[model samples]
Target: MSAANAPTQSQLEKDIELIKLIRSRGLVPLITAEERPDVPRLSDVQGDVIYGFPKASLNHALNIEWFFFFRIADSGSFKAGLSNPDFKPTSSEDVKNNLLKIGKARQEAKLSGEEVKRVKLQQYQIAFSKTGLLVLGIQDGIADARFDQRCMRDDRVFLGDQGKWDDLFDKPGYNEKDGSAHDVNNPRALHGVFVIAGDDDKECADITEKLKGIFKSSIEIPENGIVQGHVRPERHLEHFGFRDGISQPAIRNLEYPLPGQNQVDPGVIVTGYKGDPVGSKRPDWAKNGAMLVFRKLEQSVVAWDNYMLDHGQDYKDVPGGKAGVNPELSQEDGAKLLAARLVGRWPSGAPIALKETSLKDDPKMGEDPKRNNNFDYSVYDVPGVSAQTPSDYYCPFTAHVRKTAPRNLDPYVARQYLESGSIIRAGITYGPEVTQKERDDKKDSEEEKFKRGLLFVCYASHLDSGFVRQTTGYGNNDFFPITGLVPNNHGQDPIIGGPPAKGSSGEERDANLDAKPAKPFANGDQLDIKLKVPGDTLNRYQVTGHVEIQPLTQAVIDFPFFVTSRGGEYFFVPSIPTLKTWGTAN
Candidate 1:
């Protein structure tokens, strides 16, 4: 069913003219020999240039497609290095084994085949390297600081010469008024990051080929075009285990007919949501600007496993406390249930609690719009009884989705109606599947396991409003199951928050951490559910054994960040002032 009638992709040409007129304020598009395969390094305009989203109709659209990107800072030694023990890079066989284990459990529970993929992903995201990557800390501006001393820039900066250094990441934010946000605000700054990936070596080569051609050829767009990077993050499956990106918007108004779906109000991604002031209040150069934040967080499986061994029984997989002593649930089953609560869906993408761990894949029912988004958190809020026992029974308050956006439990009416899942994701996994040798040597030490983790990137309009604030403060609170009443309820998102330590929190005593963090639940569900769990139960487990992170100096990150940035920069993907002004004006 063609649910949408997207505009013919004849809009890319129009965007070119406007961009040529403004020509990115600070950052220069590093047209490498390969990227500029069609033309020489500095080719003159052919007849006319087009820009923006050729995929959509640009007629009379005020919003031009903005290109938000971070050039990799390091750009060296592009190796996956799975032999290293740092990330515990799971092998192809290991992935298959884990999948098999999850599949058997689902089958025994009677869940269908369709739900299996979801469970596989939960395991995958944790065990492997992440998709988008980022770097934090200090360095001189993005340009190589050592280059200046090496005399690479002596010709350009002091000797009044024409030559410059080959350094990357040393650029400024764009500003028309003062014309300075680049290297001038100066020195190494904390750089945000993102990237597209390949199906294999060949696919990446194919993308590189396409990109090289595009950067070289100057094409035309219809009106004012926008460029949205689309990727298939599915060597496994789509996010949350469904064929996502299908439900996303194509054209603002023409294609999308839903209410408030015309265009996300500017405030959605741009900063200054409700009362925040705009433009003038910002720096002279940042008038219509936005900053992106990116990070490469590695999930620790060993720690995560240890926590589950101690806490899995509360969910019916094991008995609470002392894994060796408890006779009820097997260690394996406990691991299974713990994984289910954190993801809100079983390995099969089935909401186990919704269906009581039947493990059947209900595609039509699972993917249905109203039903898909329809879980209510209110029933869990009540003190005495839950319409369904085990309030966080199916999903924990600390699960990824629940912590990010508390569906239905609208604390602030305004934010509730508006909250969308965290900013757009541009990611690619690094490192290979785990190997048998690494698995066997798992106990050797933290330094002997995996190479990398997810290189996660996010697009944000502002620092406080986007990535920085959430991961730091709001991202991991645990008060989700309790609903409307709890103190400082920004609970920990179990999937990303790292694991709660052994013998701490209800997850230790009860599989569900959904109960109010403030108000607790007791040991058993059938006999008596208590209003509060004692303070002794909730232990704070260590999130990660992070790799050494180099600091950022002079605004640009120093050479060696955890993600090991290669190269990247900020660019203004412009609107169509060309046909209206640039083309005619020139």
Candidate 2:
């Protein structure tokens, strides 16, 4: 498709991809710029941005938004049993205990295959202490102007492989094996806002701290301009349960992306869609700039669990007994399956309903860095292949990744993108891991039951198309049409759909039979699962019957929806140049 016709789905996909990078390394929540004014002023940035925000003007002050991930800050003091003094760190010898802790963390960190573990071992390497983060939600009105004036002209610091594309192509992963093109315009990528969060952890922290002070005490910005980084515990699991970052676009020439897409030209993610309705509205200052959407979406754990219980199936067995709902499934075998279907991937990060190449995680394949995320879903010897296409399966349609971009099933993945195309998301998990207080309260109040999730902060080329279009409609809305194999049966995503209520329509996901045991047919409120016989003669083709999806959008079927968004906000990350000019502009 031409740039003008670029789909909004592309932008949201990039945001997911970007955030996933942050999650894998535990290095997101990139800090940038110092705040000063009432409405903090920002330097003009390049490219399109997302989120609902205010316009920056000559008389305004700068607002510097900082990201504070819950995991990094949730101190042991908050919870009792889970993080007691003897949990691991408090009572041990400093270095000796730290080594053990590092070892344990390393084991868990291998979710990215081995690349993440092998990359480096400094706590501050990815998200440094001194590094300042400047997050923004480019207001819908001035997205074009802010992006142009700030993005392209800025130093483009903190971010990697951005300024250097050609050199990345010569790396080992770029030459062969994966056939997918690494287009810069892949829906999942970042285009605007140069990061000042340096390479070292200390530097990142130090700079970030200093910048925070600037936002708080500065005289130039507005009072409401800068939103201090504080832990918002009540709302979403994390700040706002954004499946913080997944599905980043692979920039053309950049070698060995974590996985997902290829690259393309910077322009694709820096302007409005080629034929976008808002393309003609851009101003001179917004030429190369992109939009940034900052959402504060909240998740209702209690409600989510209740929805699952009301509509989900019962666990026939746990390690010792049978338990089906959240708490019941917490440590049960079924718990793992429930969470897997919810996230569309095993906690190991493996997709449940979908598997790209094989069921197992391949070190050579999973850690290829480049080829890992580059595969597009090709039909399984036929057109409109549904069950585990070449790209990804073992998950559900509404799962986070697929819901955001919809993948190549559209054939448009290979086409030229619209100006307001790609998006690059980056966020961090926030809040405590299932707190006792919250869990206890959940038995009665859903508002108190949620576990920690991710604080979502994303950058996109266009606001309305990228972040706005996707979350609000593409993946956010339940009615988004799924142009799938069965046409009418193409349902919305089951795991991470954009439903109004967690599961207002009541849904259920069906997991085909696993090796150990299979969940029996369940009768839920609006969700019911009954095995179907595919061929002419009814009960013929059958395997290890498992559970998959019954989406909310297609209420007729029983797809249990897992992930949900509660609330969020919009802000802007000005270009470094924009930051410097903020106070002085007027």
Model number with the top lDDT: 2
Instruction: Give a tens-digit lDDT track for model 2, residues 446-554.
Output: 4433444444556654555566556545554443434444434435555444333443443334456335435544421122234555465656443222223344655
Off by over 4 Å in 1: 1-200, 203-234, 237-267, 270-291, 302-311, 314-330, 352-371, 378-394, 411-422, 443-449, 478-482, 485-491, 498-586
Candidate 2 off by > 4 Å: 1-246, 253-260, 271-281, 301-334, 352-374, 379-395, 411-421, 437-451, 477-481, 484-491, 494-566, 578-585
> Mind giving the per-residue lDDT tens digits that candidate 1 earns over 237-325?
22222222111211211121222111233333333232122423432222222333333334344444455566666554211224433
Using all chains and alpha carbons, the TM-scores for the candidates as numbered come to: 0.43, 0.47
Q: Point to the candidate with the largest TM-score.
A: 2
